[model samples]
Target: MELVSLIIMVLGLAALVGIYVISRVSRQHSPQKRDENIPVLRDADGNELSSVCDDVAARDGKRPSANARDMSDVMMSNVSGKSKGVHQPIADAVALPPQLVLFIAADIEAGFSGEEVLRALDNAGLSFGDMDIFHRFVLSAQGETSLFSVANGVKPWTLVPEELVMQTTPGLSMILNLPSQIDDGDAINDFLLTAERLTADLNGILKDHNQQPITPALRAGLLAMAA
Candidate 1:
């Protein structure tokens, strides 16, 4: 009886060992599973890094290329607020006041007296109160009709150097300071006739501030002052 029980115990032990061997062989012959320790790549901003290639390559200790590094640098610069963009400049705007001015330059011979201009204005039935040297001449008209003047040129009151003083000589030109006080074509016609007659008497050529001949174009523009 004891011998039979020992044989049974041996057979049971061998069977357990055989089962353990089969399990070990099956495990060894089966596919091996690699342990992957993927790193969550992120900037200092705590964003997760992803993508199969980047994650796998990073685990394998492989780095990106030069262009990739440059792109990363640009992205980092933008994230860090170190990048810049194209900028533009602004310009100033200026406005001019609603003041109308007209000029009638003249061509007088040398040695022409300024007093002759004064006489021409007087003959037009114009009167004066004060003489502003810078404004050169100002003649008052009847009933707020208009105030006019005949000066060397436009803004004749401007002081010139002795070398440039020839520009201010009488008979060189005359500027008629005509303010748009009358809104009638007859008034403009009368003013033009008076200026024309005076300029004819002085033997001066009638021109604009630019010394361009006063054509019908100029006359039509001046007519708007009366309107």
Candidate 2:
């Protein structure tokens, strides 16, 4: 009986020791608890998690990634050339913001002298608005066109004497200056109409910088902008 009791006590002690070992091993292999201080980063749609490696690099003050830097440089280059291309606005043809110049020229072989030219200007129903001793003349709008005025003190448009015409070209050229800084679109268009009429009266041709004829279609388009 004593031997049987001794064996039972040893078996119970062995069972308790086995249970302790299993518990300790299971605890050692179990997953650790999540840390609450770490944030869970997600993409824009929350469909997937974003890489936290970038955050780590940023925190360390490292330069941006090579792909990011390359994209930035490309965007900046495009912005730098935005105003330098042929993609200018259509409105610029009629109303140049800074300044606009129109050259009206007539051939001198029309059997008319400079005195006749001055007389035609007087007979063209044009009122003299301003004049400069430097042979600059500002013609006034004869009718409703006179209603428009520029905000600045700048004289709208004037015909200035051309020394070049006096020396060459077998004709006379007049410069119409419309610096918008001193004149408005209405004034500019009104002056252009006067120039065209006077050129026709003097039997002169209106030519542009490239000597191209000023077509009626182009003049109509610019005049239409006033309405």
Candidate 3:
């Protein structure tokens, strides 16, 4: 029994020694590395340790590419709540009746309602000019309307940047004629902003007056005015 116990202890110690020998050999064979089993390079005198990652890695990690940075900057600029007050287009402002007529004509041609046109205009903050008039009034069966038709005959609603396709209906519904006393000389800052204010002009009148709720498309359009 004494011999058996001694043998067991000696075997345990021998196993421990073998493990230690293996660990030491492994450490010696594979030196300490930063990561990925790749060793850090030592400068002369071993003071400065250079990593596997180079200056390119540092740059890629820190700064975006020029185009990416520009796009990011522009996008950030768009929604940064900058006040673009009442930016009317340089075109001659047309009268409300003519504008209404044009809107009606465009809607009729597009198989949409006057309401949709009005809402889009409000969202776009667009106004009427000769081109605007022409587009709204003179399209054939499958044609687009002018920016003026989209805006509800409001002055200074003319800062609509071009390229807004005369979409059929607003995906979102908004109240165009919310009871706000806006003047002719109202400094719009941004038409869409005014439109949102107009849309919010509701207590009971909105449910009673507007049948359709504002569509997401129109909401997107209004937000797009900032862009």
Candidate 4:
């Protein structure tokens, strides 16, 4: 009886140990898929996560892993063109406590720069937002499409070189100045509506300026942002 009990206990512990190891290995190996096309990362709690690519790295050996995003160290990545890739929500990923930071981005067509954004915010009388919001919008254009004539016709938004940021995802967005931080429901609604208006205006400029037909996905994104 005693021997049988000991064997059962050992097997139970072994199973637990195996499960733990598997979980650890999973996190180390699986890259986080970027889902929200909204640009920046907000916690499941709706708070803005630091989108700065502080620790994006591919594994050196057979078992690949990401560069750690601790404040002390920084790394770079070829995939995200930065330090780390995203990891999906873990078990602890619950709706954050009381308040979370919101991420608002300006499309490639909109004039979203530090100075212009500041000018807009100041002109708009908005505050509490920062560079994280305004400066790092990832811009994507049809590389095949030439905008030389369009460039002459209408100047697309430009950011300072250092301010030009990339994302782990395939798309583009801007992280503007954190001059006005809006939290949750109302803030998100206002932000979305405003973004739509900006895109509608940009689409007009693209049509008249470059005689470009905005792609379906781009138009969809614009409409979603507006909605």
Better of 1 and 2 by lDDT: 1
Q: After superposition, how far is residue 51 of candidate 1 from its true place, in Å?
A: 79
Model 2 misses residue 20 by how many Å? 99
Q: Highest lDDT: give the candidate number.
A: 1
Q: Residue 59 in model 3: shift from native, Å? A: 36
Whichever of 1 and 3 has more TM-score, that candidate is 1
**Candidate 2 vs candidate 3, lDDT winner:** 2
Model 4 TM-score relative to the real fold: 0.22
Tell me, what's the RMSD of every candidate?
44.2, 35.8, 24.9, 23.5
Residues 93-159 of candidate 4 have per-residue lDDT tens digits of 2221111112233334332334443443334333322222222112235222110100001112222
Task: Name the lDDT of candidate 3.
Answer: 0.30
The reply for model 1, stretches above 4 Å from the true place, is 1-111, 131-146, 154-168, 172-179, 184-187, 220-227
Q: How many angstroms is residue 110 displaced in model 4 relative to the true structure, after the best TM-score fit?
A: 27
Tens-digit lDDT track for model 3 on 83-149? 3442342122111110001011111212223344444444454444442321122243445422212
lDDT of 1 by residue, 102-142 (tens): 23334432423356555565676654432321222223355
Ranking by TM-score: 1, 2, 4, 3
TM-score of each: 0.37, 0.36, 0.19, 0.22
For candidate 2, the lDDT comes to 0.38
Name the candidate that leads on TM-score.
Answer: 1
Q: What is candidate 2's lDDT per residue for 164-214, written digit by digit as tens?
A: 123212232332233322244555566566567656776766543223466
Clash count per candidate: 3, 0, 18, 34
Better of 1 and 4 by TM-score: 1
Model 3, residue 111: distance off in Å is 9.8
